[model samples]
Every structure is written in C-alpha cells, then in structure tokens.
Target: MVSSDDTYLSMRGGVSRGIRRMGGEEIYKESQDCRILNALSIGDVVVTSAGNLPANKIFHGTVIDWQLELFPSKKIIQKVVHDCLIKANHYGYKTIVFPLLGTGAGCLNKQIAWEIMLKQIIMDLSTIHQTLIEVVITLYGRETLSDLNWKFFINEMQAKWEIK
Candidate 1:
C-alpha cells in the first residue's frame, strides 16, 4: 500500500496512522488477523473491511517494492491502480478513494505520481463501463497538496476533461 512494513495495519506510522486515527486502535488490532503481509507484493492488492472508517472496505495496494526502488515504474503504478479499481468494481463498491500511489515513503516524485495516477484513472474510467459511481483522489496534509501542485493539477484536469 503506502510502503508499509510487515505490520498489517500498524497504528504507528505512514498511511496507517491516518487509518488508525479514523478506524481506531481496535481496528488495527483486528486487522492483524487479516494477515495483510501475506497478501502484499508488488502490484498485489488486498481488500479489508474498514471497521469504523466511513467506507465499506479499504483497498490496500502495493504499487512499489520499497526494497527495490523508491520510485516504481509508471507501468507498474498504472497496473496497480487498474487492478484496485477492477477489484473494487467486482466487490460492488460504487465509490472509492485513492491516494497518489507511491508518492509517500516510496519517495516518488509527487507531481509525476499525480500525473500518472490521473492519466491511468482517466483511461480506466473511459474504458470500464461498470458499477463505479465516484472516484475521489484524496491528498492529505497541506504539504502534500502543495508538493503535488494542486492548483495546476486541477487546472490541467479541467482542461483535459473539458470541465467547464
């Protein structure tokens, strides 16, 4: 997912901190039973019940192997996102939220990661005629938003998608 360690959903660090904050400590404890590590590998994904979080499920995706590279290949990122979306659709999820994949501890270039993520999402949405109702790409923290050039990203998306 967000370059997590063997701890399934540890309450200590990274994206898990946000997840733990929202879902509570009990959820993290519960998640340990899920064997999240076993499901993780580059390009692999696992879906778990979100417990107290305001979503039906949390899709954990591994877009990069941290031991190998800080920034993964664009093709790998696209495939991971595509597979996650496909799994969400299969699970009958109408709405899903995605973080900029590999932009966290993976140390990916934020702007490039955003661009790749947006491009892949746009392509997927165009190709897949399925149950997906909404796809929300969320950026946490002011720093992350700034680093990602949020305004430019929005403007570019508007231009590309012909949003009026």
Candidate 2:
C-alpha cells in the first residue's frame, strides 16, 4: 500500500515517484481509472490492480493533500490505515504492506508519523481476532532517520501482542 495525495496525480515525488521509477505502469495508469472519478478526501482509500508489480493489489490512501489548506490530521492517518486493513480483509488478502503515511510528500515529521502509524496498526490488529492478518510497515528513505529505533519500537509493540 502507498500513501497518495488526494488528487492522485502522477506524483513525480514521494511514494508514487518511487513506484513509477520502479516501472509500475499499471499502478500509474490508475490515476485515469474511471472508478477514481473524483479527488479523494483525507482518510479515503482506493484499491487498484498493481500494474506490473508483483503485488496482487495496490491500496492508495488519501493520507494527505499538500495542495489543500487543511493540515494533516492524526485522525485522518488512523482512519486511512484502519480502512485499508478492512479493505484488504474484504478481498481475502492475508497480508498487506504499508508505508509510513505522512512522512513523505505530506512533509510530516518522521517520528510523529511512525508513532501514529504504529499506534493505529496496533489498535486495529487488536480488534481483528477472527483471522490472522499479517501487516508490514516499510520505510524507504534516502537519508537515515537515526532518531527513532524503528525496529526496536516495532518489536516492542509485537511483544504486547505476544500473549494474545
């Protein structure tokens, strides 16, 4: 899954840019897909076929809209992440990968973004006892974000789920 701006334009930067750079032609063309008729609002999620990528699907969440006047909200981030998980379950998917929602083009602080994303993941997973859903959060940065020990933080959260 990737965080996309509300407009879903051919964003030449951020997550979209990386995918494009890696030859995600089908994913790129979803911008013109009729199902995406209008600009998405914050927290909205749209699923599309992964172009040439190996994944079965791509979940594009509207976690930010840098062009808009509205500031990114923690609530919006939580909503998008949770919604994407639900959507994945709807498709009978056992696993879904997500990127830090607001850290890239959203211009959000990396630490805050990670905290918000991890918290939302934990909360959602807590309520999902019906089935085992594996979730992965990946960070792709040009420069090291040494401030947060992400591996340690994620493992700490994993331990809380140890007995559940």
Candidate 3:
C-alpha cells in the first residue's frame, strides 16, 4: 500500500502537449456536462453536480479565478486541500489523487507552492490517523516535472512519514 505522507508528489510524462503555454488568460468553456460554481467557505468545499466524468461526484475547488484572480493563494490552496481531506474523511475514501494545483495556468512559484501545499497537508493530517486515507499528487508532463523538483517532494514525504 502507498504510505501516507504530508505531501505526495510525482512526475510523469504527458500524452499530449498543450497548444498554449500555461499562465496566460485562457477561457474554459463550460459544457452542460461540466459546470463551474462558486465555493462556499464552509469546509472549503465547492459543490458541483455530476459531470461527464464517471465519478459519482466532482468537487470543483477554485484554484484560479479570472475576475478575482485568486490563483491558488497559499490560504486558498490550503482550504481546498483541507476540503478534500474533510470529504475523504467523512466519506471514507481510502485514497484520492490530486494534481499540481498552481502549475497549470495558475502562475504560481513551484518551490513555494510545494512548500505551502506540504505545510497545509501536514497540518491536516495531524488531526487524522495515517491508516484512514492517503492522497497522491499527480504530475503530468515534463514541463511540470522540470519546474517542480521531484526530489524536494520526495524528501518532504520522507520527513513527514518518518522514513529513515
């Protein structure tokens, strides 16, 4: 079983490269199948109905807002991460995978983002047992991997899990 860590980050290659570079203003068309909505402050969970995806539920956490341009602030990101954990905690989800929040089109600093993410996750896990749930942060493509040093994340994970 994949062990629980304060942060779980990985690097992998992407199947297809995006046409445009990340961090510019790009419009995301909302389909009838997929809708975006405002997130309530309570538990930092954004409630969205069933989307085209197979998952019974899709939680939309706003990492970036055009009008507000909140773009994965450390506080906002932490709240979002916390909400996911709370959902998993209450719903009994054993494992949930997450993507790098601010790397794609969010214009965030990679090293800083990793540090902030790990800090919040460690804080969240302090209240819960490790056996209950595990989260994996998935990285897709060389661009992401290049910016985010995989070794840093791995080291953070080791420290959090008490691995020698």
Candidate achieving the largest lDDT: 2
Candidate 1, 130-152: lDDT as tens digits: 58888877775665566667688
How far in Å is the alpha carbon of 5 misplaced in model 2? 3.2
The CA-based lDDT of model 2 is what?
Answer: 0.71
Clash count per candidate: 0, 0, 0
What Cα-based lDDT does every candidate model obtain? Answer: 0.67, 0.71, 0.49
**Candidate 1 off by > 4 Å:** 1-12, 25-39, 66-71, 144-164
TM-score of model 3 (CA atoms): 0.59
Structural RMSD, model 3: 8.9
Model 3 residue 52 lDDT score: 37
Deviation of model 3 at 12, angstroms: 22
In candidate 2, position 71 carries an lDDT of 48
Q: lDDT score, residue 38, model 2?
A: 70
Question: Pick by TM-score: which candidate is best?
Answer: 2
Q: What is the lDDT of residue 111 in candidate 2?
A: 76
Point out the worst 10-residue segment of candidate 1 by lDDT: 1-10
Which residue pairs show backbone clashes in model 1? none
The reply for model 3, stretches above 4 Å from the true place, is 1-44, 49-56, 129-131, 143-147, 150-164
lDDT of 2 by residue, 1-164 (tens): 55455545544668767765674676667765723587566677777777767777777777656557554578888888888888887788778888777677677777777788888878877777524368877777654547667777777777876733
Which digits, one per residue and each the tens of the lDDT, describe model 3 over residues 1-164? 11011110111112101211121112112211233343233224433323333333334444655554345677867777777777666756677555555656566676776667767777788876544456666565654656767697778778978879
TM-score per model over all chains: 0.74, 0.79, 0.59
